[model samples]
Target: MAPTSETLTAERILEATEEVLRRHGPAKATVVDVARALGVSHGSVYRHFRTKAALREAVTKRWLDRTSEALSGIVAEDRDPEGRLRDWLRTLFEAKRRKAGDDPELFATYTVLTDENGTAVGEHLADLTAQLTRIVRAGAEAGSFETTDPEATARAVFHATGRFHDPCHAREWERPGVEEEFTAVVDLLVRGLRGR
Candidate 1:
């Protein structure tokens, strides 16, 4: 059987929204653009998402889900903390490379780093840091790390990784070895945490 009207409508709106985000970016994409793409009225789009912020949040969440799944896959298979951290960092850097042509506005909206001030935006990053900190604490307990402040270390490493993976960095813009260099930096970080 075919999908219900509501299901089909929802799918159409999401598709339209993605297209608009790609074409005009998140800040510029409006309900009208999505409505036009879906061949529906603006009211119909509103019926699915009451506000533009909600829709944008949904988009950002979807992107994060994709990222989380990628990271989780790496961690799930590697029980070694050092290996797991290496894989996780490599996956993130690789994702960035793969997303080079992706919508910049969408990317910016989905980042967890901007929530440094404990504000609403920081809420998501806080959760992510908590999770990473848990892993760091475990590693420390297992003698894989030499840190008394796993939470702080995790936060610092997270920010450092972001700097290394920055899209507009001069070295990142240089050539093909950027991915390898990113992984090397991650390896160095893990080794330093081991304190050997």
Candidate 2:
């Protein structure tokens, strides 16, 4: 049971759900499990999430938001757009690697949660791509980049760098010399975006 002092808000529920998901994994984690972890009834959880799928989707979005929120700070930095772009991408790679390495169980659980919650995943991607677009557009405005289509260019850069950040490519992130490969890819991407 949660301490009585701690209210069972949506945030608390999401937090407990994440722990539950981590403990039992996506295949077996349930609302009852989350409620049990909270020392509340399943009915209380439903009052906040409405449905079992709703709870899962909310938890998945919360998980993805950790990365998105971190990247958004880089996007908001008032630095050379090219440098900001590089830092942004590197930060993304580091964040993904940390998630996979620091908590292998939770990371594996999120892989399944993400698959089951496409809308959450889609929104996360859109948020990420939008952040990238802001950086690309800023570069174009400063004449640091040549592309007129910042949105398209952002999309390309994102897809091109997917191996660094995509969970599906998690296996490749720790390969020997993968950091060199990531640097090479980033260099090529930055060079491609720069003016002649």
Candidate 3:
């Protein structure tokens, strides 16, 4: 069925772009491929996204937003900040692990897209750090943590746990004892934050 203009929304374009990227990888995927997939004109896709770069960036942002949105819930929970932080970290690690393990080709395509869209990648890092800052600040406020610089602490925690969440380390995620190592690191981080 041909998609009418009424149904040709930006979301649809992005969805089609994702499929194109999955099929073609970032190197070969193009705005034309996206339009072809939708049975629409490339101009129609361009009407929604001003440029090919813009479209790619939007799809990259969309992909990263899924992780941010999932972690946002843990940030909002009114529970022990320590537990919340742990859950938040674990959630992020699991999310990354799943993405890398579940659909590796799509994951690799996104890795390329993310590299090409530095602005979107930077924004994603900022958002993730901001979420971490909130969790750290809450922990400090609740007397569960002893950090005076929550933002810096959050960044440190993020970097320290990079192995579990960073895509570059995706291969190691499936290694034996990886989860145990992640838990050990999280325990050390929480204990360190508690001024132990």
Candidate 4:
């Protein structure tokens, strides 16, 4: 089935926004720039997104959704709790890198460490960590992982992994061996979870 006109318009606007961000960076990618790229009036963009912050949020949400969609299938296919845990981290790092390259806000996760309204970014991190902890706990219960504190372990692992996945951090170590280094970290994390 074909997409509705509204859907196409939204996608076009997002594509334009992505291009704008790539060219001008997030701080400079204004709604006017997006509107001009789409040859639409500023009001048109506003109709879909009431504020520039709203638009940026949508872009960030869409980027996360896309990354989730890519990995959800793979995650579902595996049941080995230890392997699944490892795969989750591996997928996350890959997805993080992919999103950082495509969406500027994702890269900012490391630098800003706060919500636009000045709240600690730990809230955002906690949401994801909680979800991951559930999975890790399941693994622990099944004997695939031997964690005395699955929740804390998950949170620590997530924070450590974020150091590599965040664009600012990735940029500092941007070289051929970086991926290998990240891979080793994840490997060790998974091994630790397995009580090996």
Candidate 5:
């Protein structure tokens, strides 16, 4: 328990909210629970977040931002664009797999939250596709890819690899030969992009 004298911050409230959500899930979690976890009043929590909906939405955005931040590093790396694309896809797949396998309860909680907060989910998808667009544009600019529209190519790439990153397909990620299947698909996409 945190000391009552500790100043309540949005980050602290968010961290507590995540733990509360992880323990109780989105349907059952409450702002009061988060406040209790943080040793603060629910009013203090509300001071940072205007309402329960706002708190949940902010937490969902925070969760999604973590993946975007992770992938942004790969997008910014100065390396062979093709290799960067491959690594980027692999990193995404691995990140999803870890989230599903490592903390399935939290993952399930988030799935529900994502459904409730469609705007946040949509924004997250757009951000991810934007990162992919940068990578594809770099590849095309470097003459490693043949694409008239990098944004379209990025969308295609993202959709093509959805099986690996989409939460709906999480169960299959642990299936036998999933990595081989992912590699084959990535190879085929890379080959297609290379104008082979």
Candidate 6:
């Protein structure tokens, strides 16, 4: 049976594109392959995403958003900002590590896609830093953190913890004592942020 428009949404196309990329890698994957995976025409996939780059970008955004979505709740919770910040960082690290370890092929595909789709990656970084800024701002308001510029502070913290969450450093994630080093870094960051 032909898939109706409702069934052939952009989301479905992106999902199929992801599978195609996972199997064939970015260099070999094509819109037609994504369409073939969905049993649809290439035109059908193009209707949802104007170009292959667009579809790839959308899939990359979706993959990055998974980590952001996982950490979003910690920002919304009414707990101490310090605790929320710690939870958010740990959750993000775990999410990235899981993606890299559990589905390395797809994760590697996304790493390439993310490099190609700089705009999507930028937006994702902005969203993450925004979340961090909120947590920092809350901590400041509660007299637990000292930062005149939460946005800058958040960005600093994000960069400082990059090795723990960045895909480029994924290979080191499983090294012995990596988790201990991660805890040490987080503790130092939190300590530096603490209000006098």
TM-score against native, each model: 0.76, 0.96, 0.97, 0.72, 0.96, 0.97
The CA lDDT of each predicted structure is: 0.67, 0.93, 0.94, 0.68, 0.93, 0.92
lDDT of 1 by residue, 62-95 (tens): 5555656667666556487776776667676666
RMSD of each: 4.0, 1.8, 1.3, 4.4, 1.7, 1.1
Q: Which sections of candidate 6 miss by over 4 Å?
A: 1-3
Which lDDT tens digits does candidate 4 get at residues 104-193? 553564233224522333444555676678778878888888889989988878877876755457564446887788888888887877
Q: What residue runs in model 3 are displaced by over 4 Å at the alpha carbon? A: 1-3
Q: Residue by residue across 9-114, what tens digits does model 3's lDDT show?
A: 9998999999999998899888999999999899999999999999999999999999999999999998999999999999999999999999999999999988
Candidate 6 residue-wise lDDT, 1-196, digit = tens: 5547668988888788888998999999999999999987899888989998888888899988988898898999998999999999999999999999999888888888888999999999999999999999999999999999999999999999999998999999989999999999999999999955
Model 2 lDDT per residue over 139-181, tens place: 9999999898999999999999999999999999889999999
The lowest-lDDT stretch of 10 consecutive residues in candidate 6 is 1-10
Q: What TM-score would candidate 4 get against the native? A: 0.72
Model 6 superposed RMSD (Cα): 1.1
Reference-based lDDT, residue 107, model 2 = 96
Error of 5 at 54 (Å): 0.6
RMSD (Cα, Å) of model 2: 1.8
- Name the candidate, 2 or 6, with the larger lDDT value: 2
Candidate 1 vs candidate 4, TM-score winner: 1
Candidate 4 backbone overlaps, count: 0
| Local lDDT at 33 for model 6 | 94
